[model samples]
Target: MENHEDVDIVIVGAGLAGLTTALALHRLGLRSLVLESSESLRTTGFALTIWTNAWRALDAVGIGDSLRLKSTQMKGFKIASPDTGLFTSEQALDKDGKFKGYESRCVRRKDLLEALVDELPPSTVRYSSKVANIEELDRFKLVHLADGSILKAKVLIGCDGVKSVVAKWLGLGAPVRVGRSAIRGLVEFPNGSGLDPMFHVNFGGGVRFGFVPVDEKSVYWFFTFTPSQVPSYEEDWKENPMKMKQFILSRINKMPQHAQDVVEKTSLSSISIAPLKFRLPWNILFGNIVKDNVTVAGDALHPMTPDIGQGGCSSLEDSVVLGRCLGEAFLNKSNEEDDEFERIKKGLEKYGKERRWRSFSLISVAYCVGFIQESKGILMTYFRKAWFSSYTPSAFLKMANYDCGNLVS
Candidate 1:
């Protein structure tokens, strides 16, 4: 095997998690290489709702302002009943005149990724370098790429998605599916649809629908439910947009006219389906997050549902915190303590210890919220709406405004 000198860090996967970590490290005066499987980034997919905590993390990494320009601040949200076809309740996220203090914004996922990638130095990210295997060398970690090249570093950070090669190589295994599927797509409304800037949640039997304005002229929407015996693959489903639309229409046929109209306007070419899965809680903090100078972050560590929209945010938080921890460790290592390996190990351990609990809590809460939203039966539906209306918008805002930094002691 060809050998390479060790660098500060090796980050695998160039998505939000990897890019965010790279930016954080740069801010901390450290340098790292980002290996991306794809050759180029594309502006695809729908928008994501980023809560205050995510915004804070973004600011910590110094890309918040640039991202803000590409996003729309969400002012409020509403929940409608599918059975009754009536608006159950509406809550302005900033209703208490606290919009300036705790604000949430939604942006196109692709846009966020592009902005993050732009912040990193050109040579910092290695595109088309698909990682095939990760081996633990005696003194450093080795990352094997598909192009018959190898790179060595003191620490390996895996920001790969749900099926992380780093995690698998480290014996973490694949994430088990949590028995749900999500159908999502970005829809463009013709000028003057009169869509509000608030998020809309439509709840019915065994399924839930959500729509959020991506910008003044477009809306991103999705539907989630327990997967049926028959799987919904992206290929087969897109072949028949009308069939899928009919499925959605049948479920929400009793809903309000506006809700029905949105579904009708959706095109098959724009929609995609993905299975909704949650990683096991124990698995998140299990295994050696740092083994032989190799570690993992983001969805590779704590993959969760989109209920709270914190999956990407939590990943960003991990990147920032991990960078800070490593940066501090590198600076503190004196000549007398010339053990770079020991220092990096300590830093990885600190990163895992500081991040595990809070990330797990967010995952658990998001799972429960998803369950409530996907509840079936008449009684549960009534209780769900009742529970939503009982809580003041301020209370929800407080929950949404939870800062990971405060919880990271």
Candidate 2:
């Protein structure tokens, strides 16, 4: 009703998208309350291999220089077949030649999130405040937290992630599992890692194994298996995190010793295991991604398979575009606060139109890539060897070419 406390904006997650959106709004002197469900900021995820497009987004919001110092730039990239111990192809990933030196960085996800939050003022995020219900009103949206407090906001932004409650409330379907499960972990070497600071990936009959150096002392490694060998693993791994580590190691033991070592040194505490999931375009086409002043970003919008590593990068792009739209709308107000809500709704519509196609296309591409990489068979194997070897710089260049537009005045 009219009894709830009001805020200019309410962000329903403290993740990459929410924080970036908040930072973008801050540039225009707009403040938001970020509600995170957990008791504290999430530090569970492993390192991220952020691409140049994402770095561009960071630069737009003013954190590129700070993060660059903490990360290692990938100069080279390689793909190999573990089943045959035969290499497919190897080349420099830096954009010096056709790539134009558009490099990417592998940084700890926690560090990136913390850095984003640090740019905001104290207590911008309210931890332990989970959303239990959301209501749409005539001029505003109501956010009902699990803690029994109700908040009203002129605009509601959802960064709640793949299994997004906001998306659910808006009738968006659950994230679709593309029949692959992944185990990710961070391995640390006290004396410093011996592996090269380059991107390395190995393909198996129906699996994918990869590792990237996050820093001199640690590496983030991940393995994706098709059809998920250990059924019911989602619950089984929850019984004990070590069990998850064992499951990953068991699969990696037969690989080359170096790949084995990456898993062996991986700590049980740093491991994250889950089925790969993506939301289909039909979901976006048929469902309502935005209505009035309510909208979603990040995984809440396009939950893609990591096959192309575009999931997080796309989300960062979303924040930039969304913030620009909202900022521009907020800045050029013709008149009173009474029409501010209308301007916000128009901004949300603009954001949705700008993002809906791009995100759905990315989701489709990543899903197709995942299917090809994880399928088993002689033909598929042969195709991978041939296709990947011919995978040109244009493939990456095409993906990295787009700009998310800078933050509005």
lDDT of each: 0.75, 0.81
Using lDDT as the measure, the top candidate is: 2
Worst 10 residues of 1 by lDDT: 388-397
Q: Pick the candidate with the highest TM-score.
A: 2
Tens-place lDDT per residue, model 1, 176-224, is: 7777788787777777446777878775567878787777766788888
> Model 1 RMSD to the real structure?
2.9
lDDT of 1 at 356: 74
Candidate 2 Cα errors over 4 Å, as ranges = 86-88, 231-255, 335-338, 392-397
* Cα error of candidate 1 at position 388, Å: 4.5
